[model samples]
Structure formats: C-alpha cells, structure tokens
Target: MTEGRVALITGASSGIGEATALELARRGFTVYGAARRVDRMARLTAHGVHVFEMDVTDDASMTSGVERILHEQGRIDVLVNNAGYGSYGALEDVPLEEARRQFEVNVFGLARLTQLVLPTMRAQGSGRVINVSSIGGKFYEPLGAWYHATKFAVEGLSDSLRLELRPFGIHVVVIEPGTIRTEWGGIAADSAVARSGGTAYARQAKRLAEVYELADRPSVGASPRVVALAIAKAATEARPRIRYAVPFGAKALLALRWLLTDRAFDWAIMRAYGPR
Candidate 1:
C-alpha cells in the first residue's frame, strides 16, 4: 500500500518538511515537496522527490498544487500541512499586520490546502492528513504568543477534523515536535529582534531571542530527522495515533502541564526561560 502512494508536503524545502519528504521517498511513496523556495527543493529531486513552488497564503498556488498532484497521480494518499513560520514577539510588541500574516500562513494556508485536498481523499475513501504542529501548541514561551496561538489553533482544528472525517476513512494526525535543530530559531529570533527594536519589551524579548538561538543548535536540540521519522510513521502506520509527540520531552511536558497546578507550571516555564 505504501508503494505508489502519493504524498504532498508543504514547507518541504528544509527542516522537518525536507526530512519527511526524503523519508517518504525512501519508503517508496511518490513525494512532492512544496515551498516558496523552489531552488532549495531541487536537491530533493536527486532522491526521486518532486519539488513544487507553493505559497500557502496564495489561493491559486494551493489550488494548483493540489490539482497538479491529482492530475499526475490520480489519488493523493497523504497531505502534510507543514508550511509555516514563527512570528515571535510580545503581544504588544508584534504589529497587528504581522500577526495576521503569521496566521495567514500557519493557519489559513493550512486550512485552504486541507479543503482543496479533502474531496479527492474522500472520493478515494481513504487518506491521511498529517499536520506538523509544535510543542508550543500545548505549552507557551516568552515572545512566542502569536506563534503559539497558531499552533494551538492547529491542535484544535486537527482534533475536530479527526472526529468528523472518521466516517470517510480519512485520518487526521498531528505531529507535535519540540525544539529541533532547524532554521526556525534563526527566523524566530530575527522576527523578535525586528519587532522589539524600539519597543518596551525589547530587553526581555532579546533575552528570549537568545534562548531561541541557543535552543536551536545541534547540541541542544534533536535533529529534523527525528521529527521526520515520526511524520513518516504517522503516514504509514495502520490505525495511526491521533497525535504523535516527538523528541521525547513533548509528552512529558504535556503531562506535567496537566498534573501541575497552573501557577506551578507557569513558574516552571518562566524559570526555564529565566526571569522576565
């Protein structure tokens, strides 16, 4: 069943998306890597992965990408909604426009792609929708308010979809990854610094920026491959779990969040990020 199956992954140019594309290709799936940077995905072609340019915020792009896949492959077995970025800054420091843009890519774009792909998957009577969320969905961090809000939305959306789509044999799975060695930190830190340049929260935001920079290094974080493995498993496993929490600590954090008092958990998170 794995062989000849088609998988379309957004944000596939790098990070977990790129890793997942490679892993699925290795498992004999016809993989399509979609991102804004088409050139970056060119290397994926060497491993039998097709690369497509996609801007999740564009309606035409999302529609055309799904259409092309259906025309070429006739059926799409999996859809990985992985195209997203982090907009990190304190709530007041982040501009409304930037926050909306963040939701456009992280939330609306994901929803659009899912809408575009659902009919085909339903027609086939079987499919999988894997959403690459983050640990921020369950927990919070300083300067990550908007980013965490988007992921929390993803968590809620995926959960609701899972129940609604069960009758159609369409499985919705969420991959919640902890900090991984990726360009994500650099992007988030840059955003934080940019938004904090003349803001009151500049000092605390910069400190959080340092944390992001330090947390994303290879020594402190797990490899993108680790999250990729989880995505692949969610795609191919029989009766896949509704949620796959990766990098080990994710589930523990979720557990602690549920068991600990709200004040205690807030204290712990703040302690980990250092004094505000």
Candidate 2:
C-alpha cells in the first residue's frame, strides 16, 4: 500500500498543489504541504496533511522546509515542484527585473528545490520529482513571453533530468496542465493589464487578458482536482510517464501545434485570443 511514503509538495496552499496534497494523502502518503501562506493550509491539516511555510524563491526558506520534512519523516519519497506564477506581458513592455523575478520563481526556484532533494533521493536510491509545468511550455502566446519562457525551460530541464536520474531509481515527471480554474488566471490577467495597458500592444494584450479571465470562470476549465489526480498517479506509479497534459484537449492542442507550421500556429493562437 506504499505506507510511510513521505511527500513534499510546494505551492500547496492552493490550487493544483493543494489538490495534489490531499490526493496523495488519501492514497496513503505522509504528505507535507508547503507554501508561503501557512494560513491557507489550515484545511489541509484537517485532512492529515502537514503544512510548512515555504517560500520557494528564497534559499533559506526552501532549505529549511526540506530539512523539516527530512527530520520529521526521515526520507522524502516524492517532491512536487509547483511553486510558480505567470508574469504576463509583451517582452518589450514587461520590465527586465520583473521578467527575471518570474524566472527566479518559476525556473530557479524549482531547480533549487530539486537540487536540495536530489542528494537525499539519491542516498535513498528511489524518489519522484514531479514538476508542475504547463502546456504553454509547448506553445507560445501573446503577452506571456516571460511565463512561457520559464515553462519551456522547465520542460527541457525535466527531460534532461529524467535521463540523468534513471539509473538512480529517481523519476522526474512533468505535469503540463492546460487552462485550469484557479487564481492563476486572474493573476496573469492582472499582470497583463498592468504591464501592457495603454501601450502599443494594449488591444491584443487586453484581448489575451479576456481569455485568461474566462479560464477562471466556473466550468470553463478543468478543476485542479483533475490535475491533482494525474500528479498523484505520476508520484505513485512504478513506471510513471514522462509528462501529463491534463483536461484531455491539451493533448490535441499540442499535436496540432506540432503538425502546423510556425506562422500557421501563431495565426491560430492570435485568432483564439484576438478581439471579437
């Protein structure tokens, strides 16, 4: 039954991270949910999930979080790198500092956490590193240059890490969720409006913002639970797949992107988000 398996999930205060924590707990894992907002994790405690105040962007915070889990549980069987956000705006409009910060959180933070856990996982001779990426990793979108760049990095990083970790019995899995009903969409929309509003790209940026807003509407996108279940499967399955693109349609979109030429794919993306 995989009893006594310990898991550490970042960004577990909400959304996909929160859902995945509960899902793994239900499946008999000793789950520790980590995020900056410990207050948001109160609900998790009721479900037998341990909560840690972890800021993945900070070196000390991440190290301390991992140390706490290791001290309490003795070993971490699974590590979910899910702490990230979308800094949405045209590359020309988004400040270089903000763009760097986005990479710090989305790419460097994930890498830092993975580095901290790999030693322990290697020593134990078995573990799973589940990275929460996005379909944006495979395709591009207007006003999402920084966000997509980070995700694309995640995809490539995961691919290489998977190959390197194979002989050590550590599996690296990437969870590529499509548009999911979460606070993420609203946040991204807000960022786009703030960065590109009243500028040369204002119209298209707002158009893209509308699409992000729609993603957050009830029933408009898949629930976090769906991605959570897929993450749970990736974490527990003996031979987990390399990547999972959730909500079903995401797979089709990825295929379409591959089959179409660059200009054709770009036109389709613009059409989907362009003003009606």
Candidate 3:
C-alpha cells in the first residue's frame, strides 16, 4: 500500500468517479473526491474519503479545490480527470451553445484541471494523471458527434501529454471505459431526443438513443468497479500502459476498430444504430 500519496478525483459524486475514489482511498492513498453535487457524495465521506464540491466547468471551483488539496496534503501524486458527461445530438440539430458547454465540461475542464496539476507533479518529479475517457473515443455512433469529438480530443491530448511529461517523470494514462452502469446513458439519450427529435435525423437519433439506453443496463455494461480497478492500477503501477480499456467488451470493440477499415467500421456502426 502506498501511504501518504494524495489523489484527487473529479466527478466523484457518482458512477465510475465515485467508485475510483473509494478504491484509491482503500489502497492507502489520501483521496479527495470532488463533484458538483456534494450531497450526493455523502457515502464517500463515510468511507474516509475527503469529499468536496467542485464544478469542472467553473474555473474558480477547480482552482480552489486543487489549492485546498495542496494546502491540506502538501502534494498531489495522482490527478484523475474524471469529471465529464455525454451530450448526444445531431451536430446540425444540437445548439451551438450546448455543444460548447459539452466541450467546456468534457474537454476543456479536464485540460484545465490537468494544467493546474502539472506544475506540482513536475516539482515532485513523480506523478500520474489518469483520464477517464470512453470506448466512444475509439469508435463512433450516430448522434454522437459532439460527445465523440470530445473523447477523441481526450485520447489525443493524453497521448501528447505522456510524451511531454515523460521528462518530468509524470505518467499520463487514459482509461477507456466501455458501457458502464451509470446514469450517463439516460442523460445522453434524452439530450439526443430533445435536440433531433423533430429534425430530419429524428429516426436515426431515436434509434441511437435506444441503443444507448440498452447498452447502459447492468447486464449490458461492465460494473464501475472494473473501471475503478483499472484506474487504481494506472495510478499505482510504476509503469502503466498509456491506455487502459476496461472490461473485455471495451477491448474487443477497440480491437474491432483497429482491424476494420474506416469505411467498414462505419458500415458496422450504421448496421447497429441506423434507421431500419
């Protein structure tokens, strides 16, 4: 067990983020779990995890949370950029403001938090950044333009960061979670329907929305623990893989994507989510 090492996990109020926070704290890391709904994380506090309110899209909230951690713990050894959500909609139908908000929450917020931690990690010369991406980062789906773009950005950003931070002895790891048991799917589906329901893409959008709803079920998706364990490994391992795709299904999809031609993959996605 690595004691006294501090860890900060964003979006820790629920789902994978909350699970990872508990797992890391159990493994002897001083864990700080942050989220917009602090009340929702009451259970985390009971498990000895430090719970705090933080909105990733809010610069002051993020900055203050990081600074408070540093002030209290003196150091941050792990920064898990796990605060994000899926906003599904047809690009043509989704409002530009909503699209930008998606980026602010899913992409820029993660980047901003990472920027805040880099200096401390560089000073320590030993730190790890774990980004919670998604299998969508590799593959794509209808009505997922904005969501997939953000994840793809995360994938690329993490790759570049690994190289840049190597000299500082900081490791950047991307956690690509497949369908996990979370409220994310419902929210995404609702957004898609709301945005594209009456548009020309309504049928495809509705079909994809059904797919998401089904995929998020307990039997369909892996447990959040699976992702939590993978993240814990990335945070603790001396040399972690640049990417950790949780559960077997995620790996399979990633393999499929790698083996198939771009057009072939597009055909497959259409077969799965296209209007019948």
Candidate 4:
C-alpha cells in the first residue's frame, strides 16, 4: 500500500464514491473526498478523509479543487473520477436539454477534471486515473440510451488515455460494475418516472422504473463495498489491471452479450425488462 499517498475522489458523498473513499483511507491513503454535498461527507472526516466541495460541471471549481489538493499534498498519487449521474428514459421522450445535461455531468465534467489533474500527474511521472464506468458501457437498454452513451464514451476515453499516458508512467484504469444496492437505482428510477409522465412510452418507462427499484432492494444487488474493493485494488495494486469488471455478474453479462447474436441479445434484454 502507498502509505501517505494522496487520493482525490469525486462523488464521494455517497454510493461507490463514499465507499471507495473509506476503502482507500483504510489502506492508508490520504483521501480527499469531493462532492457538492459537504454535510453528507462530514462523517468521512472522522475516518481521516478530507472533504471538499466540488462541482465537476464548473471549470473553476474543478481546477480549484485539484489545485487545493496539489497545494496541500504536493503530489496526487491517484485520481478517481466517480462523479456522475444517470438519466433513464426512452431516447425520444428525453428532452435534448436533459440529455445534454447528462453528458455535461458524465462526460464533459469527467474530462474537465482529468484535464485539471493530468499536468501534475505527467510532471510527476507516476499516478493512477480510475474511471468508474458501468456494464452499461458494453450493454444497452431502452431507457438508458444517454446514460449508456456516456459510459461507452468513458470506455473509449479510458482506452485511448491508457496508451497515451503510458509513456508518462501514468496508468488509466476503468471499473465496470453491475447493479449495486445504492442510491443509484432510486435516482434512476425517479428520473424514469419523472420523464415518463404523459409520454407515449409512459407504461414501459414505469415498468422500467419498477425494475430498477426492485433490483435495488437489499436482496438483489451487490453492496457498494464490492465496488469499493475494486477501486482500492485499482488505486493501490502495483500493476493494476486496465479494467476491473466486478460483482461477478458484470463479467458474465459481458461474456453472454459477446456470445449471443445481436438479435438474440436484444431479445434477452427486452425479456429481462419484462414481457413487452
């Protein structure tokens, strides 16, 4: 473990980000947890995690957060870009503004923060960038078009970055997680319900919302800790894998999708969404 090494994590107020911050702290990494909600992260301070307010969508905020961390720690050993949200609804029903906002947060925000951190990492000649993508990156769903698009972009971005940054001695890794029991499902479900109101796809959207809610129930999904462990491994392992597909089901899903024909995979996905 890199004792005293500094790690800056976004979206650290809850879910995988919160769990990852704790996990990294446990491994002796000096953790700076950034999110819009500072009160929610107050508990983390007790565990030695420094909390910072950050809005990834704002360039000044992103730059200042990195500058503050670099000023304090001198060098950032790891950067975890986990600050993103999902917008779930049918493609046609989702307004272009909302879709743009989704990309603003998921894609542009991530890219902005990465830009802020890269100079320091490049100068140091050693660092890790772990992007929390999703199985949705490899698979698609009716209501997740925009969300999946962002993850797919993340997949490509990380791949290209890994090669480009190799000469700088920096490693870019990705974590593709399956469904995990967290606020993610609730947020996604709520978005679906809101977007479904009065739309032609209302019924199907409602069903999708129910599916997310049920999947998020304690009995079905993996705990946030599962992803936390993956993040920790990516941040600390001597030679971290380029990508870590975790909670088991994600790997199986990716494999099954690859093995099946396009029509067959689409049929399977549709069936899983409930009888059409």
lDDT of 2 by residue, 41-104 (tens): 9999999999979887899999998988888888999999999998888889998999999999
Misplaced by over 4 Å in model 4 are 274-276
- Model 4, 213-235: lDDT tens digits are 87776677899999999999998
Model 3 C-alpha lDDT per residue in residues 1-276, reported as the tens digit of each score: 579999999999999999999999899999999999999998999999999999989999989999999999999999999999999888898888998998999999999999999899999999999999999998899899999999999999999988999999999999999988888988998998998888998998789788887877778977899999999999988889989998998999999999999999999989999997
* Candidate lDDT values, in order: 0.91, 0.92, 0.92, 0.90
Inter-residue clash pairs, candidate 2: none
**RMSD value for candidate 1:** 1.2
Clashing pairs in 3: none
Better candidate by lDDT, 2 or 4: 2
Measured against the true structure, the TM-scores of the candidates, in listed sequence, are 0.97, 0.98, 0.98, 0.97
Question: What's the ranking of the predictions by lDDT, best on top?
Answer: 3, 2, 1, 4
lDDT computed for candidate 1: 0.91
Q: Candidate 1, clashing residue pairs?
A: none
Superposed on all Cα atoms, the candidates' RMSDs to the truth, in angstroms, are 1.2, 0.9, 0.9, 1.1
Off by over 4 Å in 1: none
Total clashing pairs for each candidate: 0, 0, 0, 0
Writing each residue's lDDT as its tens digit, candidate 1 over 156-249 gives 9999999999999999999999878899988998888888746887876778887887877677888999999999999999989888888887
- Weakest 10 consecutive residues of candidate 1 by summed lDDT: 197-206
Error of 2 at 93 (Å): 1.2
